[model samples]
Target: MGYHFKFEKIMSVKEREKNEALSAYNDSVKRFEEVAEKLYELLKKKEDLESYQSMKLVSGLPVLEIRHHQQFIVNLQKSIEQYQKMVQNARNHMLFQQEKLMHKNIEVKKFVKMKEKGLHEFLEEVKHVEAKQMDDISIQHFVHRGS
Candidate 1:
């Protein structure tokens, strides 16, 4: 007879769960990266605007134009703050997903180890039975020859 693991179904279930967790983790990472990139772009734009505003000031730009620049800069700062919060939230979610994936991986490994141990025991039992049958045959052969 072939070796059969009693927890084969459970092992299969665990493997499926691991795959789902991995997919979720990947999605979280992607979202986090997108949010971070947006934050970087926002910071770069703010820097460029501040630099241009400084250059314009030295070139004797009108007071009205200066006010407009200041207003736009304030709006940009508010947006940057909101984006920063979004980035932080995304990072937290990614970390949570990573932790979940790790747990699923550990569970799958445990089931795999149990299956390996069970198979090893089954093989050992098969070997022991074969050896006993061989000894019985040898004794029978010797007795028949003597008779």
Candidate 2:
């Protein structure tokens, strides 16, 4: 049987942790992108409304209606501010997730390195034993021939 890696169980656990961390990071990124897209749309709408608000009023438009538009624009601005905050929060969350993923990655890599080192040492030991056995067999053959 092949040499069993001593740290195999630990390595597997670390790998699973890394996978979970990656999934969480991806989710965080997706959520951040969604919030950012919404913020962009809100900003675009605010810009369009502000431009429309700047237009000269003709006799066709009622004064009450114009004031309502102005009030609506103010409310929209407040909504935009709130969305901006949400976007920022999402970005922060994404950063936190990224950090967690990085930590997991590091842990997995450490275990992988340990396993590799262990395997290399095992192979070297096996090689040495094989060479020693070969030497002993050749010496025995020579002794039998001499007899």
Candidate 3:
């Protein structure tokens, strides 16, 4: 009975740890996804800027087109830098999440081992009790035979 109680306590602690780890991982994943989406948006904006720069004006205007193209290039460079930073941040978060998952896995393995050991001990105790009961019955039968 005491063993059972201890096993339950261990299981409860393991469960709470697992839940906390899962929540933390989920939050990390969400943040990574948001960063990825922002990066994608930035890339799309850069593509649009490139497409705009390729457009030809009706007045055969080289000067205005060149100035506009230079400004677009500068904006594109800034967007690219921002996108790169976001991607790096996301990668860092993913690595952190992976590390957390590995730790959680180790904890789960330990709890499983404890649960298995506890069950084995309980079964052995039950078996011992059953054998003792059978022995008691056999002794009673022998005494009745003599009577």
Candidate 4:
């Protein structure tokens, strides 16, 4: 009576999987961006600190103040190193998610193609059946007119 794809359920499942994969990819990208931003900020702060330290040196700041600046710069470098690692890990995770999403998209596309092909075949069959019915009706009318 109606066109029904045998793999409709499978297609729906694949589509759902694709959506989940897409969401995961988006989340991973967000995480990567956040970590990268933090790393960038840390680097910028370190540069600014170094510039300030140089200015202080030119201004003849005290030895103790120079040591304090050096200590703070060291701590900033450690933090920057940690953030760099975090950013790398996040980027790797994002790439992994992207690959998974690509696979899911391909799967969904395959199922969609199958559904389209099935629908096309079903429509063709319907057209053939309708043409046969029309031919039968025409034959019946012709015979009645002959009688």
The best-first sequence of candidates by lDDT reads 1, 4, 2, 3
Indicate which candidate wins on lDDT: 1
| Model 3 backbone overlap count | 0
lDDT of 4 by residue, 1-147 (tens): 998889889989999999999999999999999999999999999999999989888979998998999999999999999999999999999999999999999998998888899999999999999999999999999999999
Clash counts for all predictions: 0, 0, 0, 0
Error of 1 at 104 (Å): 1.0
- Which runs of model 2 end up more than 4 angstroms from their true locations? 56-62
Instruction: Assess the local accuracy of residue 65 in candidate 1 as a C-alpha lDDT between 0 and 100.
Output: 92
Cand. 4 TM to true fold: 0.97
**Clash pairs, model 2 backbone:** none
* Candidate 4, pairs of clashing residues: none
Model 2: weakest 10-residue lDDT segment is 52-61
lDDT of 3 by residue, 1-147 (tens): 434546677767877887887787888888888888887887888787666656654435588777977787788789879878977888798778778877877887888888788889888998899999999999999999999
Question: How many angstroms is residue 17 displaced in model 4 relative to the true structure, after the best TM-score fit?
Answer: 1.1
For residues 1-147, could you state the per-residue lDDT of candidate 2 as single tens digits? 487888789889889988998999999999999998988888898888767766646335678978998888898889889988998999999999999999999998888788888889999999999999999999999999999
Error of 2 at 12 (Å): 1.3
Candidate 4: where is the Cα deviation over 4 Å?
A: none
- Estimated TM-score per prediction? 0.93, 0.91, 0.82, 0.97
Q: What are the runs in model 1 whose C-alpha is more than 4 Å off?
A: none
